[model samples]
Target: MLKPILIQINPLDNVAIVVNDHGLEKQTVIEEYQLTLVDDVPQGHKVLLKALKKDEAIIRYGEIIGYANADLEAGRWVNESVTRMPEAPELDKLELATRPAQPLESLTGFTFKGYKNKDGSVGTKNILGITTSVNCVEGIVDYVVKIIERELLSKYPNVDGVVGLNHLYGCGVAIDAPAAIVPIRTIHNLALNPNFGGEIMVVSLGCEKMQPERLLNMTAENKRIALADEDIIQLQDERHHGFESMVAHILTVAEQHLEKLNQRQRETVDASHLVVGMQCGGSDAFSGVTSNPAVGFATDLIVRCGGTVMFSEVTEVRDGIHLLTPRAANEDVAKDLIREMQWYDDYLTAGKVDRSANTTPGNKKGGLNNIVEKAMGSIAKSGTSSIVEVLSPGQRPSKKGLIFAATPSSDFICGTQQMASGITVQVFTTGRGTPYGLAAVPVIKMASRNNIANRWYDLIDISAGDIAVGKKTIEDVGWELFEMILRVASGEQQTWSDRWGIHNSLAVFNPAPVT
Candidate 1:
């Protein structure tokens, strides 16, 4: 028989979450706390440790997560229905850089074998990315990509794979609108990712609003591609060409890029060349207790090794902005963090909804009462590193170390924006389980509960859940994850997502009006 376990995160906490996989039944006795369960608390759900009157504050993680709806007795289940979410922290009243992070010891001698680009960026994979100017060419691009995989991929064993960077933009209703820059720059930067090996090839329909030249010249901060006339293949050109001729031309141009990519070789580089993104979805209560904290530990290690790490999802960070501002490297970076939060707040207001909409049914069922509680847990992946910089959606980092990339909380959009910002690998934590992956980079999945890890044995990469069962310490899992990151980045190991080929389609965040 299994013993019932309850985990209290802080000395001030009035509630503790049920840790046993099957939960504890009513009348169950816990000798540690000298209390009996008044209700059947489900796994990951919280149980009150002290009786409270109506509207009393409910505390967890040493913070007020919510307020009781009515008088609540001790040992009772406290779920979303019984808890009223507190208001978000006031952004204007926040103190900037009040408690900056203490310096961490240096982590040196970590390296990975990666392909080096002439622009000074290192890539974990060498791929030929085929971009498109408009959605009209999407079908053709997809078609030709299949043929290339079948015919040409085998010829170049050095190239990892080919990706057709197709999206639902170009020739749309409001291409010149002020907000249009979001998707446009996103598509522009996507083609220049390190994995593409700087072999920029675009299949244009020739009549799209977003011209090939304009897209290529979107930015100069990153080394812009010197547009070659032959690199842009116009399917609508007045040549003696049918569908087969177009396919033949595309295949020829792709082969040229492949030949260049195949010539590149992997060389050992320090971990400073690595850019990692951390995110979570389908989260549960143990997220903060196990997986996220473990990820945070690894995040700190990456920063210590002089690598770049970014954690995003704007709404998820909104409530925790107060906690993060003090850790900023300086006042300017602190303001930059606040600016992104204010922008997202206005964006949400324009849509007539608030951050409360962020929590899903799965999240509530997993013991997250509301967005406030979820946000507190979500920011745990940032670790204790100082905030070195802040970035807008799709904007690449100017400096290294820990960065805050402002992006939506949706898993797909967040992943896409992170990739555009130039992340070569991602770590995703989940408790409810997700098969999410991206074709452009490798995704490592971490599970928060022993049950999920055991049930989905082959799907999960690292079992942070063992911390919850007292089988492993957070430091043990942290070092394990940090080592695994180097191996995966070096191509010495394959994540389950890549091994199973479970790549989700790219989802661009288009806040502008869609025509």
Candidate 2:
């Protein structure tokens, strides 16, 4: 028999998560009987409450997670439990019930000095981005950015910076394929993003799968085409003269746009205009208990204020989908969640890979025993909001409510996609920690533990460990986080990632090729 250790989550939950590191090492006293140990278990893991038949449902958080693969004994550890059953929360005592529509209040009239675009979108920075359609032209884009940094930017006070958003996959994939569509949409979205001025300098090799014209069409209203007749004519003239002449010509043109971009400033906008992306990296056990819930509360506050909150990484949503599905705007949205889950399953199966292989070695060391537990913790960052829409990777939410974007669980990839989808700000929760930033968006790092925050104060924007110490409530931390978000959006604050120059990157969803 296993020794019973009291672990409580909620009053209604039937089973307590096993905190014992070696629950299956030997027979120990548990709740009911002197049961013999069945299998080895890890800490921050779960074990069965009773015997479960093959294909029987496994329940946690009082909801079905997945079904059993084989018969489970009372003392057996449930390894990667998979339950198909769906359980709904009791309406009377719901923690986050769908309440009646309340009149929303805007954030106290405060605004950041930012660029106002022709399309009514606001930009936190005025940047001149040189985007390429394929890796073949990445060098050229980089060269252009370097030239801008060296010559043009020195004269322009208004321009934030110049950058080349490069990626590996743009060709050798089917046109409009899932892989191709993501990058194409991402480039288009980047061009339309409010942070950049009306002018964009597009560089293409002319034969990539993601054509530059596709990007141009998306931002038809305000766009500047390069590598065309006039630009080619200019390039030819500069080459004939000398390299210095070419550099000078580029700088002169860039200065014009920089002057125009700098003229814009931030103005007060309603909170409804804000869209925030929730992300986590280097997560630990404390992630779910502290920073994640704190961010979740902020998520709820944003949604209540008629703003949008986006949670991507479909893989991380596996265990929490049940908890989230009930809050979907309708059955279709819930079905979309199911469809995405199935797609990931099929993707792994078709590739002849174990789906559970997605869990990182670091996760296991940090007290995350399996994907279910990690996912449960990851989804807590969304709080309790109705999923108003489901978006493919790189696609923006059409309606204003909580959204789920289908993306890979890798932090850089997920963060990149979130920014590409037009989220101007990101709240990255970490327990272990990573220094990551996006090209165009600002990331605010929130540490889950006090020790981590103290040790890496340079990289952490907020320490949410106060919740664990009972010094602050989740609501209090959330309001503080919301204020930080505003400050970041308004250009008043800088993230640790930004200070350290950690602009790690990944493109929108591009699936691995099936051999």
- For 132-240, candidate 2 gives per-residue lDDT tens digits of 5667766555676787777768677767787676777567766665455566676666665666755665555666666667655554322333434332213333243
TM-score of 2: 0.79
RMSD of each: 1.2, 6.0
Best by TM-score: 1
Q: What's the lDDT for all of these models?
A: 0.91, 0.68
lDDT of 1 by residue, 1-515 (tens): 68888999899999999998888999998888888889999999999999999899999888899999999999999998899989888988998998889888988999999989887888888989999989899999999999988988999999999898888888874888887878878888898789888899999998888888888787655446687898999999877278998988999999999999999998999999999999999999999899999999999999999999999999999988999999999999999999999999999999999999999999988999888888888999999999999998988888999999999999999999999999999999999999999888889999998888888888899889889889999889989998998998889999999899898888888888877
Q: How close to the true structure is residue 415 of candidate 1, measured as C-alpha lDDT?
A: 95
Clashing pairs in 1: none
Q: Which parts of model 2 are misplaced by more than 4 Å?
A: 1-7, 12-60, 63-113, 176-179, 207-209, 218-253, 512-515
